[model samples]
Target chain A: DVKVTQSSRYLVKRTGEKVFLECVQDMDHENMFWYRQDPGLGLRLIYFSYDVKMKEKGDIPEGYSVSREKKERFSLILESASTNQTSMYLCASSFYGETYEQYFGPGTRLTVT
Target chain B: ELKVEQNPLFLSMQEGKNYTIYCNYSTTSDRLYWYRQDPGKSLESLFVLLSNGAVKQEGRLMASLDTKARLSTLHITAAVHDLSATYFCAVSVAGNQFYFGTGTSLTVIP
Candidate 1:
């Protein structure tokens, strides 16, 4: 089974503070993604990395950035956290080819106050 | 750009009842996925429909994809309380990125 682990399950930060959410996958997948799940809006992609040091902006990449220094780890960074940034963040990873199924992390519920 | 939409944003059904959630997407796609998510939790993979008329079943849930129509359906038979969760359908156009539907929130009441 594939396992995706997030650094924090819950986090609280004040406004204008920088926040980091970490995700690691044991399967050594080549694709990693960051998404924010919201009510009614569903899961919106924030950023995705296809390979180490390669990143692409998704539909909702504003106010957020990502890092993929290694194949197993992907990081989401909030340059300046705001109250609007509070949401459940999810990390996912998939293999290099064939299947597009992404294994997701447990998710981190971030609260920006 | 690929867009995925789900109908009947909210559904409430009794145990042993049957219902289907609809997912429609724009443009062509070779891969469609179904996922279940509990409140404040991550998504759980349910089905991966890869081709037209592709169908996959697990437990009381069955997912079917019609690539020609750009639609997918998730049917629930004799749903139980444990099946109460938000179901989402996602479409992968380029086999790289997935666009998720708005999601269908289902509640199974006894």
Candidate 2:
């Protein structure tokens, strides 16, 4: 079975705090992505990595960054957490060549206070 | 930039009723996907339509893609409470990059 795991199911952070959300996939996929889900706005991509040490910004990557030190792990970082950043974050992984069909993790619901 | 749109952002139906959710993309793309997300949970891949006139069905749900029209439809037959969830359609314009629609929240009332 394909599995994707997130570091936290729910997280609480204070304003200005640095936060890291980790995602790991056991399927050995080459593509990983991060998206934030907000009501009425849907899921907006934050960042994605196609390979180790290779990352690209998505449509809404202004306040976020990503790290891919290893093939199995992709991390999303918030340099300064703000209340407006509170939302459900989803991580997904897919094959390098086939990026359309992706498997998603359980998601991390982050609350920035 | 690619944009995906879903109509009737909210849908409410009784048990044993039928309905359909429409997903439309702004640009040309043959790869499309449908996902179901339960409340407070992650999304699960439901269908992947890669070509024109591709139709896939599982249990009570059926999905069809019309690449020429840049449209996809998810049809629900005799929906039950268990089918209640948020449905999202996504389109891929490039390798590993997708644009998701606004999503449709469906509630199957008993």
Candidate 3:
């Protein structure tokens, strides 16, 4: 079975705090993605990595950054947590050259106060 | 930029009813995907339609894609309470980035 795991199911952080959300996939996929989901706004991509040490900014990557030190692990970082950053964060992984059928993790609900 | 839109942002139906959710994209893409997300949970991949006139069915759900029209439809034959969730349609434009719709929250009442 394909599995994707997130570091935290729920997190609370104060403003200006640095936060890290980790995601690991057992499927050995080459593509990893981070997205924040908001009500009515849907899931907006924050960042995606195609390979180790290779990352690309997505549509809404202003307040977020990502790192891919290893093939199976992808991390999303918030340099300074803010109230507007409170949302459900999701991580997904997919094959390198396939149709990009992504498998998602359970998600992390981050509350910035 | 690619834009994906889903109509009937919310749907409420009784058990054993039938309905369809529409997904339309603003760009030209042949790859479309449907996902289901329960409340406070992660999303699950439901269907992947990669070509024009592609139709896939699983249990009580069916999905079809029309690439020329940039449209996709998810049809529920007999909806049960288990089918209640938020359904999102995503389109892959040219690369790895995917555009997701606003999603349709479906509630099936028994």
Candidate 4:
């Protein structure tokens, strides 16, 4: 079984504070993704990394960035958290090719006040 | 812009009934996936349809894809309360990237 774990299951931060959400996968997958899920809007991609030090912006990347310094870990960074940034953050990983089914971690519900 | 859309955003049905959730994508892609997410939990991969006319089933849930139509269907047979969850369909694009639908929240009333 593949295991994807997040650093935090819940978090709270004040406005303009820096926040980091971390994800680690044991499957050694090459592709990692960050997504924010909101009610009615579903899961929107924020950023993705294909390889170490390689990152790409997804549809909703504003105010957020990602780091992939190692193959097993991916981190999502909020430059300065705002109330609007409060969301359930999900991290997923998949193999580079063939099957692209993503394995998701337990999400982090971030609250910004 | 690439888009993946699912219909009947909210569904309520009685146990033992049948229903299907539809997923439509805006681009041409042969690989589609189905996932189930329980409340307050991560998503669990359900099915992967790799080509047109591909179908996969597990227990009460079945998923099929039609590449030409850019659509996928998740059919629930004899719906059970345990089957209630938010279902999402995703289409693979540019090889590694995926566009996910808004999801269909299903509730099976006992």
Candidate 4 has which clashing residue pairs, if any?
none
Task: Predict model 2's lDDT versus the native.
Answer: 0.94
Provide the lDDT at A100 for model 1. 75
- Residue-level lDDT tens digits of model 3 in B1-110: 67899988999999999999999999998899999999989999999999999999999999999998899999998899999999999998665778899999999999
Please report, in order, the local distance difference test score of every candidate based on alpha carbons: 0.94, 0.94, 0.94, 0.94
Pitting candidate 1 against candidate 3, the one with the higher DockQ is 1
What is every candidate's C-alpha DockQ against the true complex, given to 2 decimals?
0.84, 0.78, 0.83, 0.85
Clashing pairs in 1: none
Better of 1 and 2 by DockQ: 1
> Per-residue alpha-carbon lDDT of model 2 for B1-110, expressed as tens digits?
67899988999999999999999999989899999999999999999988899999999999999999999999999999999999999998775788999999999999
Model 1: how far residue A101 lies from native, Å: 0.5
How would you encode candidate 4's per-residue C-alpha lDDT over B1-110 as one tens digit per residue?
98899999999999999999999999999899999999999999999888899999999999999999888999999999999899999999877888899999999999
List the candidate numbers ranked by TM-score, top first.
4, 1, 3, 2
How should the candidates be ordered by DockQ, best one leading?
4, 1, 3, 2
lDDT tens string, model 1, B47-105?
99988999999999999999899989999999899999999999986787999999999
Clashes of each: 0, 0, 0, 0
lDDT of 3 at A109: 97
